[model samples]
Target: MTYCLALKMNEGMVFASDSRTNAGVDQISSFKKMRTYNNGTDRVIVTLTSGNLSITQSVVNLIEQRANDPDVPNVWNAKSLFDVATLFGECLREVRKETAAYLDQTKVDMGVNFIVGGQVAGEPQRLFLIYSEGNFIEATEETPFFQIGETKYGKPVLDRFMQPETTLVNAIKCALVSLDSTVRSNISVGLPIDLVSVKPNQFEFNSQYHITEDDAYFSHISTSWREGLTTLFDGLPAPDGFESNTQAAVTESAQPLGTPVAQTSTQHSQTLTPASVNASVAPVQPSSTQTEAESSSQDNQSSAPTTSLMHAAQNNQPAQRSPAVAANQQNTK
Candidate 1:
C-alpha cells in the first residue's frame, strides 16, 4: 500500500507521498516514493508513484536509463509537461507488459500509477496523473489535484479544502495533514514522507522536505489537528432528535412505578434497559382487600409471572400474569 498526491495550485505545485511499503504483515519496509529528474538548468520533473514496487521502480529506471540516450525522446528533452507524462505513461505500460507474463501466473498485481509534474524552461508548471493502462489526464483548475494509492482515508480534507488558488504554504500544510490522516487510518502507510514544492516557471524545486516521526513541525501539525478536531467535535451542538431522545429517557425514569408509558417503535425494538429488567423480575404483592389465603396464593403467583415476563421481554412480547392469578380474580368476581 502507498499514498501519493500532488496539488497544482496557482502559487505553484506540491507533491507528497508516504514511504512505507508492505508485501505482507511481516514484510514491511520503507522506500522513497517521490523521484526527481532534473538537469538543474533546463527542466525539473517530479514523479510520485504507487502500486507494485517492482513495476514502479522498473518504469522509473527505464526512464532514467533512456534519459541520456540520443536516439529516443526522454523526460529531459520533452518540450512540455504533457510530453513528459506521455513518456512516463509509455514506460509504465512497457514495464507492465514485460512482467505481466511472469507475474500474472501467480496473480500478482502489475498495476502502477504516477503523478508526474514540474516545469520545463519555457513552460509553466503543470501536473498529470498517468494511469496503469498508459493513459493520462492533466490536472486543471477545476480539479487541481491528483491522488493515487490509499486515497480514500485522506481525500475528505483534500476535497473540502484544496483549490487551485490556494497558497503554496497552506497547500503544503494541507498535503501533510492529508498524508497524516492516511497514515493514521491505514497501517500500511507510515512516516518519513517525501515532499517537494515547485514554483511556477522556476524550472527547479523551490523547497523539499524529508519529514519523519521526530520532525517537530509535522508532530505539532498532527497533534494539533487531532486535538483541535476533538475540541471542535465537543463544541458541536447535538444532532437533531438527540436531545429529545435523552429528555424522553429522563422523563420516563421519573414516571411513577406501574404507570403506562407509550413506547416508540424504536423503543419496542431495542434491548431491555436495566430498569425494565428490574421491573420484570420484581415481586408482585397482593392488595390490602385480599384475604390471607388469597394473599398467600398471589405470593405464589408472583414467581411464575416473573419468569414469564423475562421470556416475554426476550421475545419482545407483552408480559402476561400467571393463569392462576386470573382464575383467582375470576372466582372473586
Candidate 2:
C-alpha cells in the first residue's frame, strides 16, 4: 500500500508521497515513489506512484526514456496537461502490455496508480489522478485536490482543511497532516516522504523537501495535530441527552433499587419519531414490572391493542401512547 496526494490551490500546487512498500509483514522495503520530469522553461511534471513496484518502475522508466528521445512526443514538448496525462496513460498501457501477461500467470497483480500535478507553458496549473487502467480525471474547482493510494484514512483532514483559496504553505501543511494520519493508521504507509511544490506558470518546481523520521518539523506537526485532535474531542459537547457529571447517584443512595432517580428523565423528552425498524433493531428486553408471572398472565390479554397503537403511529394517525410505552413497543417489534 502507499499514500500519494496532490493539491491544486490558488497560490500553486503541492505533491506528496510516502516511501514504504511491502509484499508482506516480513518483506517491507523502501522505494522512492515520486518522479519529476521537467523542460525547465516550458513544462514540469511531478508524479507520485503507488501499487506494484515493478509496474510503477517500468512506467517511470518508459516515460523517462521516451521523454529523452526527441522523436517521441513527450511531456517536454506536450502543449497541455491533457497531452501529458495521455502520454502518461500510454506509458502505463505500454508497461502493462509488456509485463502483465507474464505476471498474471504468477498471480501477481499489475495494478498501479499515480497523482500527476504540475504546469505546462500556456495553460493553468493542474492535478490529475491516473488510474491503474490508464484512465484519469482532473481536479476541479469544487474539489481542488486528488489523492491516490490508501486514500481513506487520511481523507477526513483533507476534506476539512483544504480549499482552492488556501495558501500553498497551508495546503502543504494540510497535506503533511493528511500523510501523518495515514502513516499513523496504516503500517503499509511509512515515511521519508517526498514533497514538491510548483508555483503557477513557473514551469519548474519551486521547492522540494525530503522528510524522514528525524525531521523536526514533521515531528512538531505530528505533536501539534495530536494535541489539536485531543482538544477538539474534549471540547465537543456531550451528546444532547447525556449528562457527563452524573454518576447514577452511587446506586445505593437510590430510595429503591428498580431504577435510580438519576436515571429518570429530567424533562419530558420529545416523542421519538421512530425510523422504520430494520434488521439491526435490538431485541427489546422486558421491564422488571413485566416479570415472568405477570408476562404469562398478560399473554392471555389482547396484544391486539398494542398492534393498533403501532399501526396508528406508522400511519401518522396520532393515537397517543405514553412515550415509555411507545418506545418499549417499538423496540419489542
TM-score of each: 0.76, 0.75
In Å, residue 43's CA in model 2 sits off its true spot by 1.5
Supply every candidate's count of residue pairs whose N, Cα or C atoms clash at under 3 angstroms.
0, 0
User: Which residue pairs clash within candidate 1?
Assistant: none
lDDT (Cα, tens digit) per residue for candidate 2, span 1-333: 899999999999999999999999999999999998887888888888999999999889888888788888887778888888898899999889988779989999788898888888888888888998899999998998888789999999889888888998898899999999999999999999999999987877888999999999999999999999898887776543234433222222223223323434543433332121122223345568768879786777645444456788789775755555767999999
User: What overall lDDT, based on C-alpha atoms, would model 2 receive against the true structure?
Assistant: 0.83
Candidate 1 Cα outliers beyond 4 Å, as residue runs: 240-298, 301-333
What is candidate 2's CA lDDT for residue 266?
45
TM-score for candidate 1: 0.76
Per-model RMSD to reference: 9.5, 12.6
- Please state the error at residue 157 of candidate 2 in Å: 0.6
For model 2, what is the alpha-carbon lDDT of residue 142? 94
Residue lDDT tens for model 1, 1-333: 999999989899999999999999999999999999877788889999999999999998999998879689898779988999989988888888888899999999888899999888887888899999999998888999999999999999999899987999999999999999999999999989999998876767889999988999999999999999998877776543235323433343244333234433324444545346434332334457667777777677556544477888889988775677678899999
Ten-residue segment with the worst summed lDDT in candidate 1?
A: 244-253
